[model samples]
Target: MLRRIPSQLAVALFWLLHWLPLPLQAVIGESVGELLYRFASRRRHIVMVNLRLCLPELDVTERQRIARAHFRALGRSILERGLLWWASAERLKRMIRLEGAERLRALLDDGRPVMLLAPHFLGLDMGGARIAMEFNCVSIYARQKNAVFDHWLFHGRSRFGDQQLLSRQDGVRGTVKAMKAGRPFYYLPDMDYGREDSIFVPFFGVPAATITGLSRLSRLTRAAVVPCVTRMLPGGGGYVVELGEAWADFPTADVEADTTRMNRWIESVVRTMPEQYYWVHRRFKTRPPGEARPY
Candidate 1:
């Protein structure tokens, strides 16, 4: 009953936020996110540690500044979730300024399924919805956490012909099915799932456990794995979604080799804009034998 009550309240609050003007709603949302971050000291520490490791070249002062900005951005993202899920199609469209969309469209025109891989960046939810509207349907692999939140997010993502599949037992099969049906599916291969379904790879000179699902799916379905990112423009000018080159070939006979190569590709893309990447995640939590966790 407690869980059910919170879920109901969340739904009510979502609609309430949706009814407000976008700017006003964003202000409120960011404020709430900032409050949460202030209280969540453990999480803040984890984010700081992650940032420091990824940007070892930066001195303490520079790293702290980046971390503070990242937290603020995260707060904005949290508050914008309701607006993203419930806003009208036109409103959502206006919220972002897209780039390299033609690159994605061109890939789809080739009659092959495309795998869009991105690190957790700004306006991810909104950006995904926009892409699904412009291109074909997208199937995204989402990690299932709270049932209530999952239910809400699933419907929210699917509202624009984008399906959300849980990253569980049938996730791989479902993803492959979607790709074979010529749908563009999305996956974030930056985090550490575990040692079982992942392998150690170099990310910012540190070993990180990276998911191999993208490589496996591409090989099985013959889909094109393309690196993409949504970066926030300065002065709150909205977001720009950029597309990079597609993977020429993936999923060779050796899964480890293929996974490592794929992680390297992701690392290269992330290096270009380190601040945009989600430095809050403990990417090195699951290290190899006799190795300590970086964060």
Candidate 2:
């Protein structure tokens, strides 16, 4: 009971922070992030390592700058989640701008199964919440270690529309059913889950153990692949949810080639917003056989 107090108090702090103006929150978040970059050495190291691996062309100084900026964006994301949890629907709609949404709506209106390819961006949750407001969607949910945080996280995500979140343990079976029922699956497939069911694909010219789930799911469900990327505007401007056009002739016979294409597209988008990408995650943690681990 005593151990839970800290998380409870942290939740309280988030609640308090939500009342402040967005620009003020951005300032506080950036200040907190700068401190994290200095003190959180382990995670800072991970961010640096990711940048070094993915953006090898950038000199050490430039990569360091981007790493520091990423921490700032990450901090803002954590603190601003309070707004998602507690703010009114009207307030949130003003903050999130959705572009190219007609492309998504056209498919959904036609009773087609659509897979929204959402990559790991700092503003992913914001984008997800915005999507929940407009459409019924299904996304994979991973349980957090802290039960208190987990409960609130789930509530905040599902508070808007008829949002259904399936656990990672439930696998894609349940998600497939939900999608077939006309729910767009908000998929995040850019992570180093493991060697199993993942093929070595080129991510930023590095051999990343990428998952083949995107191709498999699309093939299994006959869903159109639509790329959705959320960009966090600087200076507390808010987020832009960019829904890209559906990929034509996706999920080809060769799964490896399709997965490679997915990674390449994500890499191209990452280049556009290098700092906002989630660099703190150990994306290259898994390695091929007999190869040394980077982290």
Candidate 3:
């Protein structure tokens, strides 16, 4: 009942925000996210742990600063979802500021499916939808926890031509189908999902148990792999979605080797904006062979 209550209220708030001016709605979202971050103890600790792992070179003060900033960004992202999911198409187009559209366009123009890799940065859900609308098709792999929430989120995400695949069961098949149809698919390759079918990969010099799905998918589908990220601009203006070069000759015959290479690529992307990266996730929870879990 409690879960349903929040989601029900969220839907109500979504409609309410839609009626407000875009700028005012964004401000309300940012303010709410800030308030939650200031008061949420569990979330605060998760952010701290993520910052500590990624930026070990920083002093305590610097780490704290980054964590606080990251939380605020997260808040803004949560608040903006109302606009992204339910706002009129014209309004959403105005709220987002895009970069690297040419890169994506060029990839699609080549007549090959592109693997859109994005870290769990701010505005990714909205940015993915924007890209999918432009390309006409996008398949994204997502982790599903609750059946009810999954149903709702999938519907919302698909509103902009982005298809959501559940990571546990249908993800691989869904991705393959998208590739065969020559459509771009998006995946977040950073999170740790236990020890099964995973290999030790260096992220920030620590061996994090990373998912090999992206590399495996590339190998299976022969799709071009491209890294993309969505970042929230300072002062709560809007978001920028950036794309980088396609992974050259990726997904060699060897799955483990290719997966390691892909992790290195993700590490480079995350290093560029360390704070915006999703540090609150328990990325290193699963230990390597014969090693103790970090947490």
Q: Which candidate gets the maximum TM-score versus the true structure? A: 2
Error of 3 at 142 (Å): 4.1
Look at candidate 3 and tell me the lDDT of residue 85: 61
TM-score of each: 0.85, 0.97, 0.87
Which residue pairs does candidate 1 place in steric collision?
A: none
| For every candidate, C-alpha RMSD to the true structure in Å | 3.3, 2.1, 2.8
Relative to the true structure, candidate 3 has a C-alpha RMSD (angstroms) of 2.8
- Residue 13 lDDT in model 3? 68
Candidate 1 has its poorest 10 consecutive residues by lDDT at 1-10
| Model 3 lDDT, full chain set | 0.72
**TM-score between model 2 and native:** 0.97
Better of 1 and 2 by TM-score: 2
Best by lDDT, which number? Answer: 2
| Candidate 2 structure quality by residue, lDDT tens digits, 1-295 | 2233498897888899998888899998888788788888889999998999998999999999999999888889988989999999988889999888899999999989999999999999999999888899999999888998999999998999899999888978899999999999999999999987899998988899998999999999999999999999999988999999899989899999999999999999999999999888889888878888888
Candidate 1 per-residue lDDT over residues 1-295, each given as its tens digit: 1134477687777778777665676566556656656776777788778877777888988876776666667766665677666788787778776677777778777878888887677667767777766765545556457787777777677787545555566657776777767677777777777887777777777888877777677778878877777876554456677777776756577777877786677567667766556767787899789987765
Instruction: List the global CA lDDT of all models.
Output: 0.71, 0.91, 0.72
> Global CA lDDT of candidate 2, please?
0.91
